[model samples]
Target: MIFRQIKLPPMLGYLLIGMAIGPHALGVIPSSEEASHLAEFGVVFLMFTLGLEFNLAKLSAMRHIVLGLGLAQVLSMLALVGSAALLLGLSWQVGLALGAAMAMSSTAMVSKLLTDRNELQTPHGQNAFGILLFQDLAVVPFLIMIPVLGQPAEQLTSSLGFAALKIIVVLTLLLWLGQKLMRPWFNLVARQHSSELFMLNILLITLGIAWLTELAGLSLALGAFLAGMLIAETEYRYQVEDDIRPFRDLLLGLFFVIVGMNLNFAILLDQWPLICVLVLILGPIKVMIITALARLFGNSAGAAWRTGFALGQGGEFAFVLLALAAGEQIIPPAINQSTVAAIIVSMLITPFLIQHSDKLVLRLASSEWMNLATNLHQIAVRSMANTGHVILCGYGRSGQSLGRILHSEHINFFALDLDPEKVREAGAAGESVVYGDAAKREVLIAAGLMRARALIVTYAETHSAMKILEMVHQIRPELPVIVRTQDDSDIDLLKNAGAAEVVAEIMEGSLMLASHTMMLLGVPLNKVVRRIREVREARYQLIRGFYRGTHEESDESDRQQPRLHSVQLTQNAHAIGYQIGELGLNELHIEVRSIRRKNQPSIQPDEQFQLQNGDVIVLLGVPENLAAAEMLLLQGNR
Candidate 1:
């Protein structure tokens, strides 16, 4: 049953199952060092995938939040824990170890949860990701500090500094060389079109880089993450991700299972009172403090609570640090064991806490302080909203071109894009672009759909587009909507769902085909398909004007406009060997539009024209005069 649902999140179930079979219960899997080794692979692959998805541009843009907020959280948590450990009369080294362990949050678990809930693109998610990024980076520094901080300072300082220097050198070299070299290598591999070879190369690169980082005294996970970032820049990134995902998932699943198997119920039972205190008292207190700090940094009340709730559990990395410190005799075996039990329990309860965070926040918001916070956040959002706008969903090629045109026309438009980097870049350029999912009503609301004059959905999967249209109709039925779809089959559905205009993809493709086919079939070069396009545009405009009640039935001025006209060439033609200008065609009240040769429009034509057999002349004039010109031009050609 569990294997059948492998695609589902197996972590929670695995944890519960592990608890049932752990040492104090059925004793199926012992609390052995081998269990720890098995669990480490999960961490490795989790880090590898995280690296694969890491967007360097976004990291650069959010560096302040990543560095500042992340560092503050770490330092503040460390300070509070260090004080508590001292109050408990633990040794200074043990105090430091405990502080370091408690300072971190579970990047793997939180990210997985966020991804599952589809909250990873939200503002809070970005902030949480930034913090996690810094924490991942902090692993190197923490490893260096462990040996020195746990031991007598005088003896370990020089070694610690040397280790730190080596790590810095390796990281710098990897970032520089990886960014410069990996893309071309991947591109070369991609051209070979061997899936097995590509998969092999991806594994080698991920493991090789992780080993290199480990050899440099940094975590293997960090190295794998960096390798992923390098590959992310390659054109073959998606393929690489697809190839490596199975291995990553299997290893990560094994890792979580091992983490669960490590639950030593005996130790947990011995320290049940302390463990409960940590889970109940310390957990909520830590969350509250973190929430307050996050709010201070301008996060919404909801965002702050989410940030706090997500970090409530002690991180997986904390166990790593604690184990390392225990080996160094810095923290006692009992303290380490108790901390592990407390961490596991906290982690097991965390998902439920986060799942219920919305209700928790809503209840909290009923309070005076929270109400004030919510009001302040609402004010900030309102102040950011500017008017006279068009909201464009999707920023793909066509959408981008439209945005440029809108900019040139000095139109006020805001773009909503799923791609975070594009959204960030567009915003940086002083465009009102937002990172959001167009399919979701909340995301649409965030993009100011209600305030806009028009909504344009330029790029989306069909289902997503349909959902957006449905949401638009439900929210503001009268709002003008334009949608672009790649299939003609969706046109009727889009229209029925309240799209004012559906630019069918097939229509555009057919038009392109017709123009190219005519050119290939020897359409006159001077006009070719231009006159056809113009007439179509004019007809469309006329129809639109009529629909808008702007074109009256009595309007003769529109009727006087020239229409598209064409005639087939015949064996006899009086105009043969005569230049179009010399033919006195204007006196005949006729205009040459194009000429078709060999059953096709000749793209190249000359004013000094000679009629040929099977050539077709297209003309524009009054209906009667055009007939006269057609008869004269085709008299001899046929």
Candidate 2:
């Protein structure tokens, strides 16, 4: 909360929390051992997720920035910074450690800050992210080398060569495993119809791969990265990202807090002059190197400087290198303590630098550069337009699938996605995809919403979907809107918000299962189709009164019932393996109108019927009872 007035990054605030409660300060978390141990998993999960996001196709597209500029930035900063440290009276090993630490920049901080500023799609922002991508991948080798650097001088040559070979071998093996093993395994997990199993599989792949790399004498981060890359090649990349993000972020915060606990306030004060000197030395050197690399690689002067400002901070990896160096005795404890303070302080100032980048760069480049950027944005807007085209929000798997179908039928549609990498790849492949948030009315208009044939929202996340729906209603009320949802729980909410068609994934999957079963049982295809349509027609009104806002009346012609809910039972749900008659639904004040299991629908399922996991129970009750019933069903008599 104090960060609100300070205007510092939340990460820095997290660090402060750690520092204040740490052994060195309040002694609230006196030992710090357990916290640090748990926090180690944070680095593991983070690297795993990073690997998942490292789409080979996307990186290959930004090859110049990723390989050329990113490589240059790291190498140059390391070389120059290392040389400077050597001249400053440090041993070669310590100098190398110092240089490696200085070469790093925070991916999480820079990307997130740029996104908040809505500059992620801008040239400079993309350049910054691309450079960060390389830095992230480079950390594996850095991790490998750090330990080797700590070894005796006689062993350095052989260890270095072995490390290089392992990196190549590990990467090649990951590629092979991704193609031959990971894909099939994930497919099996997905087919199990168990969300828990699916999530478990995700965890296994992540931590298991991370462990494999650690066993191979490489960093756990490297293994996790490879695992993520393997998953990225599959259709489940985004879902995997969503499933693991909360765990990753939580553990990552723990990791950062541990890092903060290492910062002794007394030491920081005692070495204030030295800390300030190091920060002053590191920030500009890193920035100048990055800016020079960006400009040399064809970025405009303003863009180059903006890129510099975005990445000026010493990254989280700097802390990793510093800690390892200290532990290995490659760098003196005093040096690590002071250098860590400098790195933390550098990170502390990055957000301010990024927020004020344009203002800072304007002083460096004339106003004409800004004008040119504006013209480019205008050109981009013009290119996104095509009258009568459908406006497709989100270009993830669902959106891309929809676009392909639309294209097959010769329907013009432009894709809008927030992921810049996806946007760049789509654009390169001659797909009509725009990089922007579709939840914004301006972004919608830019995609030619007014002249569009219809709107299809394939984005995940209910809140953003609702916002897009509301905006669409406000802009052109008559435009047919179809939205995809993860489940039936939000159907009524979306329907009430003016969605013409709300596809509930769980219910639809159940319907498909039922339909296929009927056909195999000698039922005619026409009969199967009619039955499936009838099921949708039955609960077509979706959930109503579940949310207060959903109680609003719709002016649309169709007046469907609003209080029905289709809730699915997860594997570990409390009510799983219990019968409807046993649960005493009447006492709970809820009614199970129907139940869907395997490939069959039971209308007003018999009280004697047993409940299994993954049963889609259609409940009808008042909002309060429905909520209680859902809780009861999932929790099993709790």
Candidate 3:
């Protein structure tokens, strides 16, 4: 919870907590086979989830990165690290196991960090994920191969051949036969309409397959993965994944904890120098290999560096492989301790390294600086003519909706989005959107922030919204900025940060639900409207005086609740040639908040501003008084 509160992955906290309480430290929890066995299910479920999410369409799209770049990265790392292990005086078997383990980078950590940084759509981010996908697939073979390598020297080749044949036979049967039966079986389960039964059936299938593989002298995780792949072919895949997620996450966390519990600080301390050496070598060597491979694969130097930096750390799967090697006595105790320690250290430092990656890239590659400038230049070019336009911080669904509405209203808008695909598709449709990070001051400036009439943050991510808000506050303090939030939790925080209005979706959704319920229940429409108005008036300052109260209310003050009405001036309108001050609207308890002119930007008119024909004046007052104000403006003294 603390880690999540601080926006860090809970897996890190799990590891640290496990290390503290395990036998090597305070010994609050004794190390035991039972706990380890229970924790291994986490790995099983993780593999299952991976298989469930796997799809041919996605794989085919990323074939080059996955096959070409990913294959190169794994092979290069294995060869490099294996050679290094030999130099350290380890046996060939141990070296091979170590190579496979070190070749893996943390999928959980890198992917989570990339998403949080909103870089998942960047070129480097895509490359990193593609490579990580291959690494995940590679774990299956390593799981099978490690035990074979641990066999006696004379038996190793035969054992490997036998394992390969077993894997092929088992996989073929499960995938082929299971696909035929899976859909019908799922259909039967769905017809029952019992969630409990459905959940039980899913559990049965996953564990039953896992048990089969274990009985066949293969890893239990291998069977679970196979089970997932079979189910993925059926329409029930998403339902199965949803039902299995809690179990997967819980087990995965426990698995990480068990990994932490296995750490022998005494052994780690004894091998401190070697541990340090491995940690120092592991990250830099992996980074260099991945960077070189990425560049060779036709990526920019900037993208290559980012991908390398992102995947340089050891992964959660590395721990799994290391444990397997240790169990088979393939790696000595001292080497296992040092390698695990080094990997943990690498994982711990990965977030910081990734966070500073762009800066590091700019420093290391001159081309990166040029790339950033070019991006900003493109954004500037898009927004150069858009004075008094609305700057949209995100171009997702919410931003897209706002962009369409703005466009329909003849309001110019420039949107910045990180998702390259979204930008491309939306731009092809002639949207006034571009690919940029609105959180950066330069991007905001290039989006015409200084000339913008209003800015709206459509995404509900508070971290990104806050950054944009901070930059906007610094650059354009007077600009009216509206922020969207998921709930009321951050409403005050955003409002205090200079937002003109903070729209909480939850609050708005609840209000809408309440209004619909009231109307459906036969409550008077006027009463429902007044109830919604009261709620809005209390929550939003800008909305406080915009809605008129019900006239049937007993209290005079209730009837006098303010309302908003917009009146378009005709050529013969009495107020067409008059300055706002000369209209004497104040005497009628009316206020002109803004005036929208055709083919021109809306403005908050001052006293000296003269009204023009076809101007839509937004007026605020009681309904009765607003009627008089409209008559006075449209005709003359009425």
Candidate 4:
């Protein structure tokens, strides 16, 4: 909770909490074999989740990055680090183990950070994710190999060969037969109409396969991962994922805590100098290697640098691999302690490194500034002649709907989206959309922030929305920005951040559902509409008094709906100098919504309020009544 409040990874907090309570520190929690074994289930569930997410189509699409860039990164890191270990006089086994551990980067941390920064769709972010995916697959082989390496040198080759054959046969059987039986078995369970039964069946499949692999002398996590992969092919994958998340997270937290308990403060302090050296070299070396590989794979210099910075840190799997290596006696206790300490330090600094990487790239990579300029230039070109146009921060479903409406009303709009494919396809269809990050001030400015009448953030992510709002308010304070949210939870926060209106999708959706349900239930349409209006007025202050649009006039039903119409009084208008009471708009069934004067906010005017020339009186009524009221205001006859 504390980490979440501070926006840091909860895994880091779990480790710290474990350190404070473990035997090495305050000793509130004693070291026990049973606890360690229990925590290992966390890794099992973690692998299971990883397997569930392994979609064949997704892998095929990213095969180049995952196979090319990801494969090269792991191999290069292993070779380079292994060579370094050999020069330092470590045994071959130790070198291999160390290389494997360092080759892995924290998938959990990097993924969460990318999502929070809304960069997962960017080139660097996608490349980082691909690398992380391959690293995760790489861990399984190391899990199998590290243990086999611990055998006597004479028995090692035979043991490795036997292990390999066993793994092959087991995996082939599970995958080939599991896919055939999984769907039918799940169907049988689901037909029972019992969630508990479905859940139990899933658990049974996960653990039963895990136990089988253990019996075959393989890692429990490997079997669990296989189980997940089989289930991924089934229609029940999403449901199983949702059901298994709680177990995965709890066990994963416990796993990290146990890893942390292994940290000896005394060992760390004694070997602080060595640990510091490892920390300093580890991240920089990985960054250089991955950066070069990314560039070689055709990523732009800036994106390549970002990918490198993102995956430079040691990962959760490093702890798992390190613990396994320690257990197998591949690494000495002192060396293991120092290496673990270094990894922890590297993880601690990773967030800071990634946060500043863009700035660093701009300073180091001359091409980055050019990239930014080219991007902004495209946006500026699209928006150059568009005055009072809507600037859409995202061009997803919601933005597309809004864009169509705006276009129909003859209102110009320019959209900025990070997805290249979305921009390309939409642009090919003649949309004024450009590929750019809306969170950046320059992108917003290039989209005509100063000239835009309003800005609408269609995406529901609060963090990115907040950043966009910050930049928008900085560039154009008076421009009305409508922010979309999932619920009312962040309405106040967004409004406080200068959003003119925060539209909660949940609220709007519920209102729509209720309205439809009421009409279908034979409730009067007028009553249903009034109910929806009341609910909306209660929730959205700025949205009160529905403003009729020109496009809506073609819909006959819209003519019957209560609408707001603004009448501008000219110098010769009959009602210009008359009082509100004398206008007799009430006889026409019109309600004065507000009075808008030049350079002033709209205000509600009471009866007997005198109207002056140039005052725009907003009247709310049905179309016929509103039209009659307008005639009465202008010509003094209805």
Candidate 5:
């Protein structure tokens, strides 16, 4: 709450609270050692989740930034920061330790901030994430090198060579084992229909892998990360993320608390001047280096500065490295304390730098240094001049179909997408499409959002679709917006979110199928069109009634109308244990017409069927009766 009030990131708040309540201060949590042991899982869980969010497809898409620019940033930071530490009279090992630590930027912090600001897909934000991802992947080797750095001259080469060979063998074995066992193991656990069991299985997977990795002379965190990556390849990734999130968050908070407790106030007070000097020097120097690297990789100056400022901090990993170095006697307590203080201070300032990145660019970069590419800017400006055109917010199948129809009808339309390949291909064929993210207000404006007749979102990501809705409403509230969804469940949500219309492909495709069948039965074209329109109108009216809270009775019917109710099963909900027949939905006059599990539908399912968590039951009944059914679903067997 304090951080929220001050508009600071929660990470800083966690750090502050930990510091204030810690042994060095109030002594509420006097034993930092105890906290550290407990908080270690925070890193383990964090790495696990990071791996779970892995996308082979997305990683491929971001290969250049994640691998190329990311590699460049890490190597450069290690060289520069390590050199600086050496200049400060630190031993080579100590310098290397500090360098490796400082080379990482906070993935969680930067990604969270950029996501909140709706900039994660912007050129800068993407670049920053890519670099952070690489840094995360780099942690494994860095951990291996830590003990090597602590070794004497005689054992250095042997230690390095042995570590390399061990890493290769471990990685290959982990991958092979994961491919053989991961999906099958999870599938068996899922069939048990117990959320607790599912969660436990996940914990086992995480800790088991972590244990294996530690046993193989690698970090426990790396093992957890590999577990997550293996899971990411399967179909259960989203559910795993949802199920494990609470544990991850609580442990992560504890981790931050441990970090805060590690701050030595006595050392900080004694080395205040040095700490200040280092923070000041490090922030700007890191920014310059990161900015230069970003620009070298084709990011414009604006994007480069934004990326630099967003990541101008010694990251969370720095604390881990310093603690390890201190333990290994690679760095003295005094140097460790000072480096920790400097790192924390830098972290404290990163949010401020990112928040005011625009002003920073304006202040530091000259007009010419803004580095706006002439052709892209001119093209964007020209696109912005378009009026009364439809703005299509995706370039996939649905969007392309819409565009073709618009073209055939000689209607003005412009499509925007972040997929450079799609935009390039379409533009080569003289299509009015451009590369841009619609979730960015600037990008929307550049796509002529203000003067557009309508906005259509065909993106599959619900979060992205919702974000675009909010952005569009903020800019043009009255503009017509039609959003496409994979299921009917999001229809009411999308509409409530300010989408003028929500098109669920499943429902519409069914309607299309029915229409084709009718035509095949010798129905006239005009009659078929009229029937389709009537069906659409009826669905829209029902949706309108649902949103307006007027489903008790219809004006035309003058009686309670049967309304569609979708009840999603939450963990341990009342309906989960009982079979449909046993629950007695019939008592509430709620007919269970169908059930949707994992995108597959079971129409008029067996009455004796038990429901799993996440099952969406389709009910048709009067409003008050459906409400009772919903209440039962939510209330569970209690």
Candidate 6:
């Protein structure tokens, strides 16, 4: 129960457990060569999952920012860091390698933090994810360059061209094959109904593609990620994901722990002063540069700052690249050790840094340049709030279509979506939108719910929707509340909590489906449409009448009519061998609507309907009569 109450993440607990058992502490798992191999698998799985979320269409839509801004940031950072390294007496090849390592940001850490904070679907989050996507893709080129650049007599020009050509060919082939072949194979596996076999195939496909990419002289991570993206395009993607998650999580935890183990605390302590200076200077400088680049590409100032804070820490891939360099004698082992130590410290502090980033930005605003960016952000927010608007929570298919209709009608409304890319796209299309969890009071306040005309929730998660409704009631009970659900069970709860309307999506869908089937069966289209319209209108009127306390007459009518009650048998019930129709239920003022046998579907009861163990019977009668019937039915047991 205490575990249920704590707002802290489960990941934090995992990280703490890892730290406690790490080599620097209890040393339960010693940092060894075998441990390193396990850690590498963690990275592989992490990249694979990341690939699953990559959308080629969406990426194409944001090509200018993702490709252009991403290229600018990566190239500039590489140049700046590499030039500095060269001046510090490092060879040019080593300098370039170090620069490439530093230029990349940690996708795993930043994406997780954003998601945990429910900021992953925000405009800033989209921009950050786009940039990270590019960085992940860039690993391929960087991997190829390392071997050529780290050579003793570096013929850089020839190697660079060859590497570029090779990457283009491999990426093109992967994309083509992934689109043409992978989706069909996944569908075939799904049809088999053997979940274990499907999952096995998923793992094999991911790792096999990754191995192929590595054999082709590209990064294994790039291949794994690409394979994931291919699999994501299929309808069975979520099923595959559900199966692979346990493996992905366990391996990724090992990766982080191994990262911690690689830190040389003694060397870190010896160079603490230098390391502190570098972290303080480089971290903010890199973030500022990237953030500025984001702003230049048309992101809001707040979004830019968010992207900066998210990507401020060094990425895990940097360690991989640095290790490669050290192995090839391109960089001194001490340099690699120091860089890894710095990265670990930076990552550890990042969560705190982000949590308090707003205050830090205000302090930094004293600078003239920073103040300019801050002012621009204020303008952006003002521009977004040209008029008071309704706030719509949840942008799934129904919500999205409703939003589109709202847009066509020229309504001023803001949307809050859980999916980062959707929110980003909405913002890009000039809609007033924010990414956030609607259940949180702070998130609601941030979205300006109190000032909005209405709150519409279009998702089917009952608890969160109810929570939002309660919060809205507490703040402004008069505000109109509209919600959509998939079941009738929550109707009373939502109504009591003050929702003005609760449209059942499943019921509506089923009704529509029935109408279409009727039309296909040769019913006149006009008659079919009229019947559907009448049914829908009647439902609306019924609900409205019920809420207005005018449904007492209807309730009396229902009481006058016979009612139904159900009794499901438990394993220990004494009536297992009894036959329902043979028990003379008619004499007891009861009727069976249906009976279900073990491992079989429910069917209408016949005279021969046997009530074996675990059978559930549906009976109909008036309340008092039903109670008497039940008592008589259980008389023999008592």
Tens digit of per-residue lDDT, candidate 3, span 275-361: 887887678878988999999999999999999999998988898899889988999988897898899889888888988887899
Candidate 4 regions exceeding 4 Å error are 547-638
Taken over the whole model, the C-alpha lDDT of each candidate is 0.69, 0.77, 0.86, 0.87, 0.78, 0.70
Record all residue pairs in model 6 with backbone atoms less than 3 Å apart, i.e. clashing. Answer: 121-420
Instruction: Please write out the lDDT profile of model 6 over residues 522-606, one tens digit for every residue.
Output: 9987778667766775765323222222224566765655655555555555555677756777876667665534334445678
Compute each candidate's TM-score over C-alphas. Answer: 0.57, 0.60, 0.83, 0.87, 0.68, 0.60
Q: Is candidate 2 or candidate 4 better by lDDT?
A: 4
* Cα TM-score of candidate 6: 0.60
- Regarding TM-score, does 5 or 6 come out ahead? 5
Q: Comparing candidate 1 with candidate 5, which one achieves the higher lDDT? A: 5
lDDT of 1 at 253: 61
Tens digits of per-residue lDDT, candidate 5, 1-638, equal 88776656677778788889887888887855666877889878888988887777877988999899989988897888678778878777877887788787787678877876656666787888888888887876777789668789899899889888988998899899888898898899989999999989999999999999889877788788889999998899999999889998888888878777767788789988878766865698888989999989887777888889988888777776776677678988777777777877887787787877876786766652334344347447768667889898888888999999998977888888766667889999998988766766767877788788788887656667888988876666546578888888877677667665678888889999999999999998878877777777677633423332323545765437676656678777877877898888888887886665542423348888888877767677888888888888879422
Rate residue 537 of model 1 by lDDT.
Answer: 56
Error of 5 at 573 (Å): 58
> After superposition on all CA atoms, how large is the RMSD of candidate 6?
14.2
Model 2, residue 57: C-alpha shift (Å): 1.0
Every candidate's CA RMSD? 16.5, 14.9, 9.0, 6.7, 15.0, 14.2
* lDDT by residue (tens digit), candidate 2, 1-638: 68755656566777788888888899888745677778878878887887777767888998988999989988887788688778878878888888888888888778777765556767887898888989888887777788789878899999899989988898788787667987788888899989899999988988888888778888777788788878988888899999999998799888878877777878877888878878986688678778888878987888888899888888877776776677668987667778887887898788778767766887877853665457447535754558888888888898999999999978898877777678879889999886766776766876788778778989656767887877876666546678888897887777677676688788878998998899999998777866676676676633333332223556451233335555767679877888888887788677776664543423347888888876667776766677788788887544
Instruction: List residue ranges in candidate 2 displaced over 4 A.
Output: 1-8, 168-178, 367-638
What are the runs in model 6 whose C-alpha is more than 4 Å off? 1-25, 112-123, 154-191, 216-219, 229-238, 299-302, 323-329, 358-638
Candidate order, lDDT descending: 4, 3, 5, 2, 6, 1
Estimate the lDDT of model 3: 0.86
